[model samples]
Every structure is written in structure tokens, then in C-alpha cells.
Target: MSIISLRSILDANKLSGNNFNDWYQNLRSVLMHEKLIDVIDKPANVAPQKGESNASALDAYAKYFEQSTTTKCIILASMSPELHRQNESMTPAHIIAHVKKMYESESRTSIHRISKSSFKIRI
Candidate 1:
């Protein structure tokens, strides 16, 4: 286990739409620690088909399924109720993409505006 408590490591702060950058970084840290970041990035293929006989294939799909489910729970628990409701049906990967689309560009534009304004501040 990490020296840091899981609570601290996971940054219990929920994503309320105003803290996307911080929330994103925190999530990345947690996923990386769990070694499940790929579940949200690559999104492995669907579960093995019924009647599948290959033991390795079954094990691979099982691993992906377990990891994906854990990632989804983490993402959901870190979201505000409204955000969770909107994304609860989505897979972990889809939820991340949706959040990025909603906030990543917005944050960049906001930062640009802030920088421009700060450069002109009298104090």
C-alpha cells in the first residue's frame, strides 16, 4: 500500500465543473496507481463471447472487466450528483471523454482570459 492514505491519494474532491484540471490530475494519479489507467484510455475490447474456450482470452477479458468496473466506480464517486446522473450510464472511457470535451477547452480559454486580464491589472 502507498504511504499516503487512499483518501488523500484519491483527492476526495468531487468534480463540480469548476475544478476540472485539478480533478483530472487527481484521477490520473489514482488510475495510474491502480495500474488501471488503460481501462479509461485504451478501453479494451468487449468481454469474451459466450462459449469462448481460450483460457487466456477469458482471463484477459475478465481482467479488463474488473478493472473497467473499478474505474467506473471511482469516476462516479468523484462526480457531483448532477454530473454523475448525466454520466452514470457511460463507460469509464466515455465519461472521461465527455468531461474533457465539456471542460478542457473551456478551462484553456478561461486561463487565456485570466492571463490577459492579469497582465493589465494596475496592482
Candidate 2:
């Protein structure tokens, strides 16, 4: 089945909504339970940005965004620790604006990097 179809089934069955990470986790669980796919984690070798500690919630959400880049970056930024850091200037609104800007002006070379990766996304 298609990704949208699978996602629809989950939503229709009340398995998920408004929580993409949880939705994907549950979807993968179902796919594995049905013996339809193998388990894989962090299939991409791309590393987190330098100085972005993995334990930081911002890093965690960024990683999630990297895995699911099709999702809005604002949504990812909404879940970032940077939004909550007392010293940070990154308001959710700021993040939203930056996300929109990045989305609209993203370079082709960045897109090429993703396409060149060998990770498989099985339905």
C-alpha cells in the first residue's frame, strides 16, 4: 500500500493524528507485525550539525525532521528544545518564518544529496 494509504488506515483506525513521529513508529510497528518490512533505524549516515549535542531536544527534533523532510520544518521546530531554551532567540514564529524561507529557497544540491542516498523506503 502507498504511504498515504497506510497513514490513512492508521488515522481511520485512531492509531494516530497530529503526531507524525508516533504515527510513523506505529505504522512501522504494524508493517513489521505483518511481516511486510524489516526494521531499520537512522538509515541515513548524515550527522547532526556540529555542536548540536544529541541529548538536546532540539537535536532530537532536527533528526526527526531530517528523517521526514516532507513534513513542515515549522512543525519540527515547534518541537525543538531551542524554542524553550532561555538564552535562545528562536521563537516558534521565528522558526516558522525560517522554515518557510528555507523551504522556498532550498538549493538543488541539498536535494541531490538525499536522492543520492541508497536508503530504501518500502511500502
Candidate 3:
């Protein structure tokens, strides 16, 4: 019901600028989509109850993260890069590769895999 910037959300959580914003933005999109689903499911109803509890947009976001083990892990992984380093020889390429693997392995396929030529970190 409210439009909050990704920055505000991250700031509230005491999270610095990182991939969390991107992830949260995508998650917000997902939350908006579920809101659309709620409107479709209940035409006259504003607040829909999920069984015994009234489900809000935040609840949906929380439920999604709670029930989905892979998504939870992915979120944590994005926040903590140190978890990916198993060996001292790990290069940026290796880190990116591991992230790619995790993204591919997840149930969600939203992460884009761009060709090297298409992506340049520094312009």
C-alpha cells in the first residue's frame, strides 16, 4: 500500500549499499505482484486473511523468505560474500562463478547471466 525506496528499506535494516538493494527491489516487485493476486482473489475485500492470520504485504514478503530455504540462503549469500570464499586462491571470477552457481541452483530464475562483452564494471 506504501511505496518505499530501496534505500530506505536497506537503511532501516542497517544494511549498507550492496546487492541487498537490488534483491529488495526485486522482492518488492514480487510483493506488489502478490498484492495484485490478492485483489484478483478478493474483489471486494481489502485485507485478506490467510487462514487464522490477516496477511499483509509485509507478511507475504516474510512468508516468502521464511518458507523458501533457497531464497533465504540466496539473500544471506548476497549480503555476506565471505561465505563464498573456501580457498585463499579465490579470484573475483571464482566468486562470481560461485554466485552464478547459487543463482542457477535456486528455484527462482530472475538473476541475469550476461555475456562478458555485454557487461563492463567500469565505463
TM-score of model 2 vs. true structure? 0.21
State the lDDT of candidate 2 residue by residue for 3-113, as single tens digits.
Answer: 433434444433112343453455555445543332132232344676867676666666554544422222332343442242134432343345335433344455556
The local distance difference test score of model 2 is: 0.41
- The lDDT for every candidate, in the order shown, is 0.85, 0.41, 0.40
Ranking by TM-score: 1, 3, 2
| TM value for model 3 | 0.23
**Inter-residue clash pairs, candidate 2:** none
Best by TM-score: 1
Off by over 4 Å in 2: 1-9, 13-17, 39-123
Which ranges of candidate 3 are over 4 A from the true structure?
A: 1-84, 107-123
**Model 1 has how many clashing residue pairs?**
0
Give the backbone clash total of model 3.
0
Stretch of 10 with least lDDT, candidate 3: 37-46
Kindly give the stretch of ten consecutive residues in candidate 2 with the minimal lDDT sum.
Answer: 36-45
TM-score of each: 0.88, 0.21, 0.23
lDDT per residue for candidate 3 within 44-73, as digits (tens), equals 222344554644665765654343433233
